[model samples]
Target: MGSLFLTACGNLNSSSTSSTTTTTQSSSSGYQTTGQSSDSEYQSVIQNGSYLTSKARGVGITQNSENMLNLKAFESGLTTLSKTEFSPKDYIFREGQLLSKSTVQKWLSRKSSSNPTGLNPKDNGETDADKRNPIYVQQIEEQDYMKEENGKLVLAGITIGIGMNRKDYYQKEEYGATYTTTISKAKMIAEGKKAAAEVLKRVRKLKGASDIPIMICMFEQAPNDSLVGGTFYAYNVSKSSTLGTWKSTNLQSSVLPTTSESTAINDNDESSFTSFKNKIQNFFPNLAGVTATTKYKNKSLQELHVKITTQFYSETEIRSFTQYVAQAAKTYLPSGIPIDITIKGSDGDIQAFIARESDSSSYYTHVFDD
Candidate 1:
């Protein structure tokens, strides 16, 4: 069986569970391994994490479809970045929960009633209504990868994360390495079984995927914060497990600062702006346009924010062009002021990254892809 390895930042250690696992067990390695149902693991071949569009965003749990949006982008010098797609469809979507964080936390603590079988395979009506839906959306981090077919986005592979309490899995001390927390093997099994059921339920709806392989994975998510990481146990038709990994959440939970101090404006960066524009054009000949704005004053440089809009035909172009322009902006524009870069694509697709001049580690990501 061919397996797809997703490059995530953390480590995952575990075994496999059949599509019908009902019980969970713990290995000597301190990882939770779920029981497998008597089913085949060669059911699907999950592809690498890729891009999608709005219409096909949650196909994993909704329509069992793959992603189809592919973009071609590059710098002026034709330099390309790593092969990754950064668009609206690349991330996961959680149902809007207006309830306070405290209330959501309480809901997650309740035991998961894992009656995996139901009429609506995507979501077991009883469990989804009683245990899963009210607590949180069950699909993992985001739809990982997919491609275009017949002018629509289909899901090639995805990571369906079962919501779990972080405090139950690992303990992070104030001044030491994180330690694995002891969680009941039964609960862990229930989580994986539910995820596998969701995959099987959705897969049944596909048109011609009976023989085509799809990779089904399970992950653990934090209750209300952005902390998401865990090993994905891969289950094949033979009921065997292959270890997989997920990206560690680099996002901080505390609210990002929105307000900036308004100080004197320096309208004197004209020459600097010219240099900036020249450098950007030299690298990205296909650059659509660049917009520079100043707000919230610092001592030397006005809070400098730049938005670079481009029209790229592929993901490679967008990735490299965005990075090239961002690096160029800092060199030409006045330093010591916080900088924000927003990249707008031809189809009005947008993504943004920010960095505080004083601290490099304080980088923040604000997704405006909507």
Candidate 2:
């Protein structure tokens, strides 16, 4: 493919809708890959307006099943950074097709007598938890970007996410008592970069992907019990086999209402969330709860994801409540940043969705019926 730079500006005003048909392919490693048809077409999740995702999803779980928050943040957080380099307007989004489940499984394994390609430190005989070499790499994720050439979509760029463990949890035997080993931030970054460098080299060798501009990010995974996900601390883009100087991402994730003593959040944003939460709950006292997860880049709010749980079952009541929520979101929430609010009933079914794009004055709303 030629240079990804384009003279035509991409439309980022609001979400656009597209339709897709599903098809499944089995990787050589035996993992079933479900995605759109062979047309290389894109499909949006209906709620997310930013980019169209590949009809075929990537074939693997990149995060621990217990820590789902990190999985969501890991993929979406990388997307936010990827957008800075690869604009969704110019590139169609697809899950990491280059890395398969079996390939990732080998890479994530600890280097030992059997698994030499493993990215983690080799196992040395040691009973002391403090002296043992911990598992630095937890999982790896890939995102591919394609650009049109000769009226066909071709691979133009790739983004790789390296998820490292802040705390390594393990069990010597099946169903045995679990043990934990803490990894320092310094050690984590060093190992993560080393693994990323190796990953770049391997990806460069993948079929016909050589010389493609690749961006690799280093993420610190949160503990299994953390309420909020971890953050990406550094990233670098490589156009060749050798990686370049790393740059700090300054990306962070936090829960709304500012509950952390160490996390420094925008006072205005916190106050706005508090007011919005209070206003709706005060009006509808039977609400189960109201909460949110926020993303910040360079300490500025970039995205807000809100979830409101209620007990109301009537469509009439849900529609009325959605209207009130939308009004409150516009009047009180921070402006010029994308905000997504989802209201659900006690049964956990989505009742309505409200969203606002960045720099847009007005918001959009939708109420679903049974």
lDDT of 2: 0.76
**Superposed model 1: Cα runs more than 4 Å off:** 1-267, 296-300, 352-354, 361-370
lDDT of 2 at 217: 90
Candidate closest to the true structure, highest lDDT: 2
- For 269-300, candidate 1 gives per-residue lDDT tens digits of 64676677778755656645665654322224
Judged by whole-model lDDT over C-alpha atoms, candidate 1 comes out at 0.36
User: Candidates' lDDT values, in order?
Assistant: 0.36, 0.76
Candidate with top TM-score is 2
Off by over 4 Å in 2: 1-62, 260-264
